[model samples]
Every structure is written in structure tokens, then in C-alpha cells.
Target chain A: MRRLRLVIPAALALAAALALPAGAPAPAEARVGGRPPPFVLPAAAGGPTSAPFRMGDHLGQRPVAILFWATWCQPCQQELPFYESLYQRYREQGLRVVAISMDSQATIMRAGPNARRLNVTFDVVTDVDTRVTTQLNPRRAAPFSIWVDRAGRIVREQEGFSPAEQNAVAQGIAELVGR
Target chain B: MDLRRERRGAPRRRLAAPALLALVVLGASAARAQSDLSFELPGVGRTTFSLTSTTTLRYRGENYDANRFDDDFGSLYQRFDVALQADELRAEARIDLFVPHTVLVESRCVGRPLGVDDPSCYLDWDLRPERLTLRWEPSEWVVEAGDTQLVLGRGVALAFRKVDLLAVDNALRGGHVRYQGSNFRFGAHGGLANPQNIDPIDLRIVREPQDVVVGGNMAVVAPAPLGVTLGVHALRVGFEDVDSIDGVTRSRFTDRAVDVAGWSAEAAGLADGQLALYFEANGLRRTQRLVDQARSETGRGVYASAQLQLTELTILVEWKDYTNFLVAPETTEANARRIYSAAPPVEYDGPQRLRGIGNQRGGAIRMDYAFLPGPWSFSVNSALYAFNEEPHRDPFEGVLVSHSWMTLAKRQEYGGDLNWSLDLQGGARFETLLHDHDARFRSGDIDRWMIHGRLDITVGSGDHAFDFIVDHRHEREIRGDVAEFQIGGASVTYTFGIPFTLTLSLRWTDYQPGVVVSRGRREYNFLGGEFYPSLEVRWTFEPGTYLSLFAGQTPGGQLCSGGVCRDVPTFEGFQLTFVGRL
Candidate 1:
């Protein structure tokens, strides 16, 4: 009887929850205000010797904004200038912008030309196997932004890009960089 | 916000009784503080014992194999997980219960616990304690034991890993310890391998031959503008001898054993964004015991990858060679993250190739053209590898006969992909991959090509959304390697504002034998390939508390995750899964 008492209401609540129609809420980022997720991606050519690099290297040096994007994303292209502007203003403030491309090999090089055209100055690490994306974006969607403070904590995460989202993300970057 | 705190911490106190009792038995220090338990159990019927259950009650309309006399009964399986944490000490445990309506007396077993000799010889329920772990952190030293995964350096040397989707429950029954500092991290682990009870091999790994693995790794992170790091890792495994004969002995038995070890060094650095360069090299040695004596062999492999961002495009080139590089039988390097695994197609070719990775050398090139950074883009990647040594097998039966430990000669695969993704409120993507491969014998000459494509589209507003996916694959193989086969599936998913989701999926398969028995003669079947359909509904009643019900038959095909790939038998029936953490 006691077990029934607990099970009945709980079942009713769950059933009611499940009965709701589709259009689920926006999914949440797993790394918000938490320890940075583990990741390793291919570094771009030149600066450092070619090797597998991870998230720990940026700690204590400066704030880092990891923009997971692909050239094909319209919003990503629109947002590239935003990141460029931010990087330009904050570069001397120890702010680093790393645009990790989730593009196919054929399209990844395209980021190079776009960066030049957009006058975007940032690092573009390539993820071939999608390992890092799998961890950070479980849904496999990109144009996602993650802000990591100098303390190595992932302080903010914004997915996709809307004008409102753009402002919030810019503010998030400003706060993290100022910190 | 306070409710969130309550949910994370409330379950901790309620579930502390039994876990604490177990911890006490393990000599846990009482002075340690406990952390909040944030896991919430999922179920329609809930309880607060910090207990959660995932129940899958399956009903197969028809027995999978008609030749079998025993009826396939409704199977009900429930898995219960428990977790507890105190300050720097933590413990987790999971147990599974299975009850089937009918058990075949003559049948071996479809599902059984780790040590059950006859899981289905008679009708009875089953109880399996699958995993248990206890960890304690004191000051800068961390010690842990029981069912743990270890990743050393680039995983070229050590990575005992598993994937749930692939039905790979492999783990190490041991412990790992790590010491952390401002600029460096190092760790070591030692454990005995756990063989899968339901390995596709169709035979139980009789305990006579178990493998033990031990390894360690260290890494140091450098400062940026150009951040660079270097690391080294190593691991060794000793395989216990296996007795080939069964228990109903009247036969002579030969015990086979091998000792394998690997060492790797990796260097990775980045220049904020200009370019990234990475390189890794691994050396391996193995000793196998023959009928009378033991013989040894040595091999090494190096991997170097570079990404060059030129204007609007990025180009990547990678190279690798691992001839006869062998790890313990239980540690398959197929999972995607391992360095030693290398790219597909370029594998190690060794004299003692069994069922895992070894012996090949090759390089690959990939180019990306997203410079327009538009929704329309594509990539091309090609890889080729050559077997340095061909594994030798007995010509009569084609088995590794008479102590000849040789891996197969290799093959090659090169492919290109076109990718497109769009997001309004929901996300959509379409990708197609075309590739060819060689699956020949020692010469590695036989070849064929295949095409695979997938499209995911989501359309709707915030109130309700519709997600659809269409995918298909066609493969052409050498000889009867696969003849000609095609597979495709479609899924429709509806999501209701943040908490509710329903999905329906259907799949189709077409298989035609391509092999010629006598001379260009083919095998024909009057019956065609079948369709598999399934429906699932999920509800997140509360943060971590939720319920899911699945019905129908999932299609049978390759199930690959984390580089480990395998084929899973189709599952027909219903499953209800509930997870709770608090």
C-alpha cells in the first residue's frame, strides 16, 4: 500500500510530462561555469610544432574563447567579425580567440581565405574525428561559443547565433576577459 | 536555485546507508568529507532510497532462430546503480537482474553473469554485479580501484577502454593513481583484463588465459601564444596461457601465451591560431610461447600530423606505421582516440595478428574548402597503407596453424565527403561519403568501393519541432566479400518544448550474394531483405529524473563507437530505462 502510494503519483506525473507535444526546450551546455571539458585537436600550421593539443595549455595565461564553427554556418560567418572585433580589442588584454573548425577537410581550408577577407585574426584548430565536438556539443550542432577564464573554468556557453544571443555572448566574453 | 541544491544534496543523505557500510568494510577513513550526490533516478514510479532502476521488458514476436526448439521468452532486465561520495572518497556500484520467461535446457546462454557456467541450461533468474569502484584522494595523491579506464599520453602505449553502444563492457579490474601539479600531470595503473561474456566469438574465454596490464604516463603543458606540450606513456601486458580443450576432456591441450609492451612519445603545440603540429611515435615488443620455447619480436610505429591554414582553406597530412604492434587481446585499439590505432586502412602487419590492430604503414591527406564559410561546403580525404609483412596462415584450412603468428596483409581506403548544415531554431545536416577499400589476403590486392549518405532535417517552431533523418549505404566487395548490399533507415523525432520527445524510426536492407561458388554461379534467395521499425518516447519529469519507453525492433547493422566497431544482433521488443543519481 505504501509503495503504491508513492508509485501512483510519480507515474502520473511522469506520464503527464511525457504527454506534452514536441519542440523541446533549448538544450543546455554541459560545461557552463564548470571545469573545461577535455579536448584534443590538430593545431594549425606554423607557430608550434605539430602535435596534439588540449585545453589545459591556456590556463593562467589569458582568457580563451573557443568558438566551435564551420565556414558553412551563415551565423558563424556573421559572427566571425564579432569574434574578430573582440579579439582585436582584447588581444593585448591576454584574450585569445581560438576558432575550432568543424568543417570537412574540403571546407576547412576555406576558413583560411575567409579569415583573411574578414580580417579575422584568431587561431583555427581543426577537428577531424569530431572528438572535441562530441564532448562539448553532444547534439552535434555548432556555431557554439564557450568562454573560459584564465582560471581555466568554462564560465559561459552560447549556442547558435541570434542578435540577442550575440549580445549575451559578447557580454559573456567581455566579463571573462575582464576577469 | 535552492531546489537545485536540494535535489543534488537530498539524495546523498538518503542513499548513504548502504554505500557507507560498504566503504567501512573497505577500511575507509572516517575523517573524509563527502561531496553532494547530484544524480537523480529516472522512473515513472519513483522512490528516495537513492535507488534507481532501468528496466527493459522485451518481447520478441518470433524466436530469432527457428531451428532452435526453445521458445524465446519475454526478458525482463533491471539494472540498479548506486553512488556515494565523501569529501575525497567516492564509490559507485551497479548490479543487473535478468528474468526470462523461458530458458532452453539445451541452450548455452544468451545473457549470463561473469562466472555462470550455464546461464540458460534451466529456467531461472540472474543477478550480476557488473561494476564497483572506490576512489580516495589524499592531499596530492589520488588512488582508486575497481573497473577503471586509463589513458596514458596519446593512448599509443596504454588505453584500456570500452563503449556501451558497441556492447563492449571490457574493463580493467584494478586501480589507477595520479599526481597533479601546476604544470604537469602523471599517473600509473595496473589491472587484470575483463573478457566480455557475450563476445561475438561465440566461445567463452576460459579463465586459463587471462591478461594483466600495467602502465603509466606523464605530461607537461607549456605556456601560450604558442602552447606546446610533450608527453610519454608506456604499458606492458602478460597474457596467461589458454587451454584449447573443453572441460569434457579426453584430448591433449596446448597452452598459448604472449607478453606484449609498448612505449610512446608525443609532442603537440599550437600558435594561438596560425598552425598546429603534432607527432607521436610508438615502439612495441612481444614474446610468444611456442610448443617448446618462447620467441620474441620487436616493432615500432610513428605518427605525424600537420594542419596548415592557408587563406580560406586548411590542409592536413598524416602518416603512420605500426608493423606487428600488438597489445593484450582484451585491449583493442580501434576506439577513435587512440594514437596507435592510426587512421583506418593503415594498420600494423605482424606475424602474430589475431583479431586486433597491427602491422601496416601508410599516410593520408585531407583538404577542407569551407573558405566561403557557407552552409555549402565539402572535404576530401584519402589514405593508403601497405603491409610490410604478410601474416602466414596454413594453406589447408586458412587458420593460423602450427604456431605461425602472422597478421593479414593489408588493404587501403580513400574517401571524400560533402557536408551541409543549417540551423533556424532546429538544426539540419546532410552528408555523403564515398570510399573504396581492399580486403584481399596476404597480397592485399583485392579491392572494391562503397557509398554512404545521410541527411538530417529539422523543421518547425518552438512550440513543436519535427526532426527527420534519411541514410543509405551501398558496398561493393571483392569476390563474395559482401557481394552487393544496401542499407538505409529513416527516423522522425518530435520534440515538445524542452522536456518531452518522441521518435519513430524505420530501416530497410537489401543483401545480394556476389560470390561465385563453382564458376560465376551466384546464390539466389526468393525472400528479400526486411524492414525494422521502432518507436521511442522520452520524458524528463525532473532535472535528472526521467523515463523512456522504447518499442519495436532496431535494425541489425554495424555498431561502432570510440573507434571500436562491431555488429550487434537486432533487438526486437520494448525497453524502459530509468536513471537516478541522488
Candidate 2:
């Protein structure tokens, strides 16, 4: 009887989620295939800069990869070099990679400047005061990434970084870039 | 106003609306519309909604007493939450339904229960909707209603809080409004402090009045370059739920009202971006009615804090004290002024069980150092508690009815905490934290030292997460003897690929002390023990949707969001849950 009680509602919900049409209206959060929000910020010193780091600027022109990282995160330190290499390899595919840092504008004077010293040459934008990450992922877990297609739809995202995730991340980039 | 007279019909009425809402959510979420509002609604902004259903089944016996076991199945808890923000308009609402079991079965929730109040131990069921709020903001101005948490500077003087245990969301059913500019901020709010006893309460026989609280806060920030700010806050409260434990209920408020006001000032940029300081002082005036006699008195409190962060090191210091009626939320206090039993009451000078942070003077200092700015860090903290009085009284200088109240005696404490994480090959990492606090307290010059220590270790990477904690306290609260208590807990989780995750957890505790006879509870704590173990499995079929199954014996637990905590009941059962966005 208890099993039945548990099964009934769960079965109903399962049927509901499965029976619904493929094109139902959903919220624009990543949890359900919603388009990612757009942002524009200034590029901090000591990073690659081509455009002004505007997400919408790449909407129709190219696929975009947004990496929300912080200088204080060790995983970010480990993964940034890989992102630099990905950018160097994909720049020809019109792939725009935005590395947003969760650091104060001035703290960059101390905690920053080391990325370039480490040979990481990628577009790094500073989200001082946490305006963008608060709207994106309030948890602010670093090494977070969001993959968007040329149409501005977010195709993939993940929090935390490790070498094992590189393959999965590569797969996400390949999907959005139509590689 | 006889609650017993209304029991039969009240539960039905209370359960109907939330149940209906749940049905609507369940139906709406079943739609296959795959596009979030982003596609269909366009500029309406983003909205998030989730529907969840949980069913529990279990058996309880053995270790309960001699030989007694009861098989029970109940508390089919269902929840629906909807939140949305479309530009300036934002709103959220959550609906919950549960078996009102254990309403009549008396349980001890006084300090900490082995498990929270279990529905399987009760005989009632109820459902309700909460956190219903709708707001409109078009630049500089904001307004909302329904339920909300109220917090003030460091929350020492006052705060509106909710504990996650038993999903207890205590919010005033009211509205608040605020306006802000570059240099000034102001807000005012008013609502039902305690909107009658919602679900989980046997309201049918529990008659209580409504508590209404109204208040406003304003702050003036120094201009762009000044780095200083000042503010004032005030509140007038009308409590209607003050009832005695036996028979007739009496009001605790003076004419059922209390008024409070305070001032706050802050200055930052003390050392470029490394140092900052703030201070706030509160004055509380309350009129209490004891039988036919009413008395009013005023009390004052002060709070000051400083923070300094340079490179990988940070330092924080805080001090606070209140000497009369307090403006703080009762749950925010480390020590509660009132006992936490089924029917908690206030004690004036002596307490059998006391936990509260009010009517006391103390300060704590904390320092942190990050090793090369990595996951490894160390910190130290020291606090001093030298109360102004031995036997304390309210501003009116009267006994609480006839009960006495006393806080922890003059005490000094120091502790150190260290956290280190190791990077492993293939992204598998390990982390551990260890901390210990040693304290010496002198109450009537009978000084003694107590030591408390805790250790937490975790090792996992990618698809697996595991952590366990061991904690114990050794001290003598009573003079005759000193006995050591032990506590331990552990959890390990493994996620298979992206769709499934399994976890196991265990908890055991035996910490009994001869509490001061005048302080309360001389009996050993037999509520929790090593007999509890739990297992859970979760399957994420899609984004924002998860179906999980859990089975175990939970003694009693804590559920906290932010810094506030509420207790959860113990349960011996299997539960299946589904949470998905519809």
C-alpha cells in the first residue's frame, strides 16, 4: 500500500513530463533548455580583447562560450590554460570565449596580472561587485561555463573544473560550433 | 475563540486551498511544452517552477522503551513552488501538504530532538501554502506582500528567520516597501507576525491570536567619496499569540504591543579596501501585562563589528548586548531566552534549560589566513562573555511570572580551525577540516574548562562525493561529576553518469550531562543514538527534474538556510520523492 501510494503520484508526474509535447513553453533558466541571458562587460587588463566582451555582440556572428571564474579558485587556475588553448584553436571558427572574473576591479592590480605572466592569453572580463554572476549563478561556484550557439541559445553548462571534464567540455564546444 | 470547537472543520478548510493549488501545478507542469518562457513569453523575463511529491513509509520500535515497535505509513508530503521575475515584477509562492501526524502525541523538542517531530508518531494531517509574495519595482521603489524574511545589520538586534527543518517557514503574512538611491536607503514593512498556527499544528484545539509587526528602516550613505553611512530603524509590534501553557491563555505583551527603535552608523575604506567598521544601537520599549497589572520599560543594546582583509588574511570582530526587551528574532540567538519544549516559556532569573543571546554582553574575534590563496586555509577565533548581572531580569525588573532566567556565566573561549584540500590525479580531490574550542567559565567563581572539537573529512572527485564528521564535547556543567559525550556522522554519495546518484549516511550520539537542577533537564539525553542510518538514490531524468528515493532512520536533524536553523523530526522510513519543473 505504501509503495502504491508512492508510485501513484510519481507515475502521474512521469507520464506528465513524458506526454507533454516537445515544444512546450518553459522558463529561460538553464535547468530546462532555455536561452541563456546576455551580458556585456569591459575587458580587464592583461587578457585577450577583440570586441568589448558583449555577449549579444556574438549572438548572430558566432558561437560564444562564457566562463565565469574567479582569481581565488584553484580549479580556475588549472583550467584557464586549457581555455586559452581552446580559444587559440577555435578563433578561426568565429568562436568567442569570454572569461569573466569574479574579482574587484582594483584587486586585479594584485591577484590578477599573473594570468598573462602564466601565458594565458584569452579575453578576461572582470565582473566587479558581482553584477553578472549574481544574475547568472548566484552560488558563484567558480570555473562555471555556459556554451551558447550563434543563435544565442545556451547548449551546455557546468560548475567546477577538473581534467576529467575537459572531454565533456570539448564535446559541448563541438556541438555549439557544429564541429 | 475555542480552538477545540473548531478542530473538526478547520483542518478541512486549511487543506483544501493548498491541495487545489498543488493539483493545478501538477496539471500545468505535465505539459510537454519544452520551451521556457524565454521562447513563448519572450520579454516577460524568466520564471521557475517545480513540483515535488514525497511519500514516506517506515517502522519504529526497539530502543524506544523495553520492547515496543510501531509500524506506520504517513506524511505524503507534496510541494509546489513557483517563482518568477519579469523585469521590475517578481513573485514566488510555495505550497506544501503533509500528514498532520503526531499532533496529539507529545514529543520533546525542547533543546534538540533525536529526530524532529515525526508525522508517523502523530494522528493528524494538513496542507498549506506559504511564501506567497508579489512585488512591483520600477526603479528606486519596491513593494511586496505575503511572506518575507526580515534582517537587520548583522541580525543582532532583530531578524526575520526560517528554519529548513520540517520545512518550517516562519514569515509574517504582510507587506514591505523600500526605496533606494546612490546615497540613501529606506524601507517600511508590516504584517502578521504569527498568522495563526498553520499546518503541523493541531489548530483545531489550539486557539491563539494573530501577531502583527510593523517597522521601518532608513539609511543615509555618505556621498560617493566619503565612505561613511548612518541610519535609523524602528518597529511597533502587536502580539496576539501570547498564551499560557495550562488552561486559560494570558497575553505577554503590554496591551499586546511592543515598540522598538534604533540607530546605526558605518564607515568603510579604513585602510584602502582592507578595513571597515560598523556600529548600531537599539532601544526597546515594551508594555507587559501580568494578570491585571501592566508595566512598561525600556532597554538599550549596542552592536559593533569590524572587518579587515589584506591579501590572504582576514580578521573580523563583533560585539553586542541587549538589556531589556530585545528586537532580535528568538531563533537568531545562540542561546534561546525561552525553552524549546512543546510549550516553551520565558524564565526570569533561573533557568532549567537556557539558550539565548539577549540581555548579555560579549564579543568575538576571528582571524583567517589562506595558504597561498588555495583550498587550504586556517583560522582562529576567541570570544569573551562577561555578563553584567548574575540573575537577570527584564527592564521592568520583574520575574517572568515566577520563573527565573540566567545566561551562561562569565566565560572565555579560544579556538582554531584549519581546512586543507589535496589535489589528486584524474581530478579526484580530498579535503578535511578540523577545529576545536576550549573554554573556561566562572559562575560564582567556580571556574572550569570545557573543550569541544570537530573534524570533517571528504574525498571524492567527479561522480562521487563523500564526507564524514566527528564531533564531541567534554565539560562539566554540574559540579559533582564530569562526563564526556560523543557524537559522529558520516555521508558518502556516488553519482553514476548524469542520471543517477546514490548516497548513504549515518549518525550516532550519546551526550548526556547532569544539567544544573536550576538550569533544567537533569535526565540523560536518550533521544538520539547510533541506531540511525539512511540511504538515498536520485535520478535526474532531465534538467530541473529529479526523482529520488531514500530510506533510513533519522534521529533528529537540523535544516538551515543562511545562518538560521530549525529542527527536523526523527523518522524511520522509506521515502520516494520527485522534483521537476513543470
Candidate 3:
């Protein structure tokens, strides 16, 4: 009991000290108005040589929309087809949409079939270990999306899919690509 | 005993100081910034610090009539999760505090002489940092110390991580290292198993056992024509036998150890990127050190899956065979979270319960078809399983169980103002247990079957939405007192422009009083209640800030997430929760 009394206060003090500093450039994070952390993940099944998809390569060339989803998530099932349509409509305008499957190793094999069932044309990558997801969506919300403009700045972030927000998501991408 | 008494008396006083300190820090930080804080040091590049806070307050009134307590109690739980990152270096810490130091021991103390003086009747106030970690990642290499999550291929050998919804967090408190290469990758981790000790749902705090574990995996990927990847993994877990007598604790390190070795192979992009396949097999050996002799036991498990995609149809098939291959000791207690490894269950993710994973064999197949040019789809899934007593004697030796389900869904949008979606699903499960010696099933043998259906509809467009859900299940068990029972529930939720949401739900079950016996007294399966009603309100203050309140009764059962399952207890109370991330 005595040890706990001392340890609790010391831990709080240390945390306070860590939060006191200010005035420095922020690191990469997946949030509105922030650049997303760079990641390279293995493309699900069908890509050429199963080559990895790198976020750094598309930063300044195209407006990218990253979707974090899982095959078992019902909302994600509905959202994937909508994103596929958006990808088809905006690909010519330098709009790149990448779907990142957050499925664990046990269910990862379903990613390819699910994507194919939706007939999606965009790149589908696997984050089985969730190394990239921990930095992007720590809450692990399904059907989460982050929109990055060509200037490497996040423009919009949305969690959960709603039919109502479909228009706003499309408009956000349209504006990012200067459509 | 003295410490427990002190904790009971000084909870409020002891909590005041830390509570005040937290508020001060939060106020100061809020005044300076709304989100994460960024700063720089002399030599360390840019640094960012982020904090997330979650607080829960629960008030339990009179519970079920059969198990009512003399007094009502409340508890407050607070958690702070902080992370700091500087270039390639990162640190994380989580602090949890619980107040009042109380436990719900009425159910266990009924009809007995045990009082508050009993150690099991009360809990000690707890405030500590539950997790702390430091990590460095330079280029393709990662080196981490302290607490970390680890997983091997398919999680058949070793898998430990956090499942927040289920309140399961199992971390390794030691060191981990990994290297990521284009064609070759490998990683290794070794540490003592650190499972969460606090039971928020049950309002109890218990000491966690210490188990040492070491594991590693290596994989190689080949490109194109072959399009195959192969990997191998190995794990060893040491269980220390501990005994406490007269307040003195003694531990024996060389008591027992479990070793597992596995290999996996994957073939993808077959038939022109339309087909994918995966297979994994593992063997486990347990050695127990006795006074002068060592006893050993062996087990094995296998899992295989395949996926094929066509122009308008997709099919998936999975199979599993496990014989005495439980990674951790099997525990039936509802509040125990001792699972160290999780293997995929080759069946639909639902409430269906299997006897045990130690001796089970099953397979499942699913097919999905989509109607192009419009948003319409249909899916059907079927699975079969069997549980045996002595798998070593006969691998396939038990009653047959089967489950099948189908769903039809549609989505539509009218202009840009109105949109709606609908999903209808129906499923059934059947099981027949045969007697050990008699070829014909006896009256005592168990025969069970259940049919269930669910309907979900959502209607909304821009700033407003409404969701309706209805579920029904009917089951019949020939060997139980509750031979026939039906469970049904319905719920409606309204989302008011993304800021506020309200939900009202009601559930009922027809299981009689004889099915469940609590404290040597017969009680209804639904905790002596036929109707369970609940109301929930959620307010989103901002993107990462929210408050939610739930009041009324809930009938909890087996809850599964990420292929892991846990049995949660029913609740009849009011809970308020607040979460803020900055």
C-alpha cells in the first residue's frame, strides 16, 4: 500500500512533465488536417508480383483515399462497393483509392475473395499484423476512411459508413482532385 | 487483512489526490491545445504526445428478485492512455484507477456464514500503470521493450493482443525484435505473460498469475508464377506452480512447460488472381516435472482454407482439426480471461457453443452472389462439427452437429435526399449426442436444435437516420428441463445529425425457472426476468470525444470478437461513460 501511494503520484507527475512541452512540428498521424503516417503493405493476392503498395509514392502525385476495413464488418461490406464506384469515376483525375484490410491472420484469406466479390478495381492491401492500423485508426473502427490531398495533407476523416455521408465523401474527394 | 481494511476505509481519501492531479493536468492541457501536443528537444527531432481518457460510472440497484442484495452500490473507473513519439522512438503508458474498493458478493454469500470479513467479499482499491512500453523502429528493423502484442501465423501457436470491446488485453512484458525485408521476414519475442487483473464488468480485482513465454516466426515469400509463401513458428510457455501457506508464497519454476511448433503455406493469385489458398499445421507437447519422473502429453492441430472468386460469385471453404491442442488451460469460469492463443472457429461467428477446442473437428463453406448494375446480394453458409472425448483413441468419434445460414440484402438511393438498406437473414443449428455404448440414442442422450432469424433496415440520407433491428431464436433440448424455449428482441435507433443518438430495445426469453439454479435456488434463465428492456443515449462532443449513458437490464451471453469468445454476465443497472482523446 505504501509503495502504491508513492508510485501513483510519481507516474502522474511524469505524465504531466511529458505533456508540458510545446511549439514543434507534428509527426505523421491519420487525422483531419494532418498528414498520414507512411506505410507499405503487401497487396492482397492479385497485384503484380504481389508487390507492396507504398503510401509515400502517391503523396504528391495523386489525392489518395485510404479505407480501413475488414471482411466480417457488415458496414464495410456495404461501403466497399460504393468506394469502387468512386474509384472508377475519379481514377482519371489522379484520385487513388486504396483499401486496407484489417483482418487478422486467421481471416486474412477472405480479403481477396471479398474484394473480388465487390469487383473493386482499386488496390487492396493486407495489414494482418495491424502495424499500420495502430498509427492510423487506434480505435479500430470499421469502414474508417482518410482523405489525403495531392499536397500530402489530410483533408477529411470519417468513421463508420452512412448513406447520408456518401455525398459528402464524394464531394470531398472531388474537391481534393480539383474536379 | 490490514491492507484490505485500510483500502476499504481510505478509498475516497486516497482517490482525492490523484483525481485532483488528473483534473489539473487535463485542464492545463486543454487550455493549451485541443488535440495532441507537439514539441521538440535539443537533439531529438519532432516529438508528439497524445492522451486518451475514458471514465465509467456504474450504479447497480436491486438486481433480480432471487439474488437481491441488501444495499445498492456504485463504482467509478478511470483510465488514461498516453503515447509519446519522437522520430523512431516511441513510448506508451496506461494508467487505471478504480474507486470504492467494493465487490458484488451477495450471490456467493447467500445462505452462508461468510460476511464482509471474508477476503472474497470485497475488493481493494486499485491505482496503477497497467501498461508501459518503449519501442524503436529504424528503417525495416523494430526493437521494442516492456509490454507488446505478439502473434504467430494464424495464431495457432501464440497470439496475444487487446480486444477492447471484450475487455481482453494480454501483453508480453519483456522484449521483442523484428526485421522486415522484401522477400524474407522474421521476428522473435520473449516475456512473462501479463494479463489484465481488473474485472470491470464484475467489479472485482484479483492477482494475475505469472507465466513465461518465448516465441518466434520466420517467413519467405516468392513472387509471381509460383505465388507461394511459406512460414514456420515455434513457442514455449512455462507455468510456475505457486503455493501460499500462512501468508508465505513459494513458486516452483520447473513445474511444467508447453511447447508448440508449426508451419504454414499460402498460395495466392492462382487461376489468374481469382483463387487463394492457405494451410497450417501445428504440434504441441506438454511436459510436467514430478518428484523423480517427468510426464509428457502430445497434441496436434490443422487448419486449411480456400477462396475462389468469379465474375459474379465468390466461394470460401475452411476446415479445422484439433486434437488435445489447447494452447492454454481450458477455463469455464465466466470472469476468467486466461486465453493465451486464439484459433479460428470454422463456423459462423455466433453464439453457438462447442463442447471444447481440445477435441473438435469441423469445416464450413460459404458462397456469395451479387447482382451487378444494382445493389443486391445473396449469401449462404453451412458448417458441420463434431466433438469427441478421446481424440487420441479415435480422431473422429462423436455426435454430429451442423449449422446453416443464408442472407439476402439490398441497398437503394433515391436522388440525393433519401437512401435505405435492408438485410434479412435466417439460420438453424442441429446436434445429436449418442450414448457411449448403445448404438441407439437413449432418453438421457442430448438432442438439440435451434432456428433463428434477423432483420435489419436502415433509412436515412444526410443529417438524419433511423435503424430497426429484430431478432428471434427458438431452441429445443431433449435432455434439459427447459426443453423448448424462444428468445426474441427488437431495437430501434435514431441518429440526430451525428451529434446525438438514441436507442430503445427490448428482449425476452421463455426459458423456465428450472433451467438455472442460483445459490441452490431455482431461477429463470433470464435472471428471474422475462423481459429485459434498455435505453441508450450517445452524444458526440467532437470527433474524438463522446459521452454515452445506458440504463435498464441486459441479458448477456457469449460475446465473440476477432474469433475469440467470452461469456459476459447479465446487468441490471445504469452506466455512464465518457471518452476523450487528445
Fraction of real interface contacts that model 2 preserves: 0.08
What's the TM for model 1?
A: 0.60
lDDT of 2 by residue, B458-488 (tens): 3334433343444343433332244433344
Model 1 misplaced regions, further than 4 Å: A1-179, B1-53, B61-63, B66-71, B85-87, B102-124, B137-141, B195-209, B220-227, B243-267, B309-312, B330-356, B371-376, B387-446, B511-529, B557-565
Give me the displacement of residue B185 in model 3, in angstroms: 0.7
lDDT of 2 by residue, A1-179 (tens): 22334443554455455533366322122333334434556455324342236564576468887788765455565466557667777888888777887653213322233344224556777664353554454335577776677765554455555443344455556656773
Please list the residue runs of candidate 2 whose C-alpha ends up more than 4 Å from where it truly belongs after superposition. A1-179, B2-33, B38-71, B100-122, B165-167, B194-209, B244-248, B252-254, B328-354, B373-375, B387-450, B460-469, B474-476, B479-484, B512-529, B557-569
lDDT of 3 by residue, B188-281 (tens): 9998987764554534444555778999999997877777889999999886464331112443324677899999998877887778888999
Angstrom error at residue B311, model 3: 2.1
Where is model 2 chain B poorest over a 10-residue stretch in terms of lDDT? B405-414
Docking class of 3: incorrect
lDDT of 3 at B418: 76
- Name the better of 1 and 3 by lDDT: 3
Ranking by DockQ: 3, 2, 1
Clashing pairs in 3: A164-B461
Q: Write down the TM-score of every candidate.
A: 0.60, 0.64, 0.83
What is the CAPRI rating of model 1's predicted complex?
Answer: incorrect
TM-score of chain A of each: 0.72, 0.75, 0.78
Residue B282 displacement in candidate 3 (angstroms): 0.8
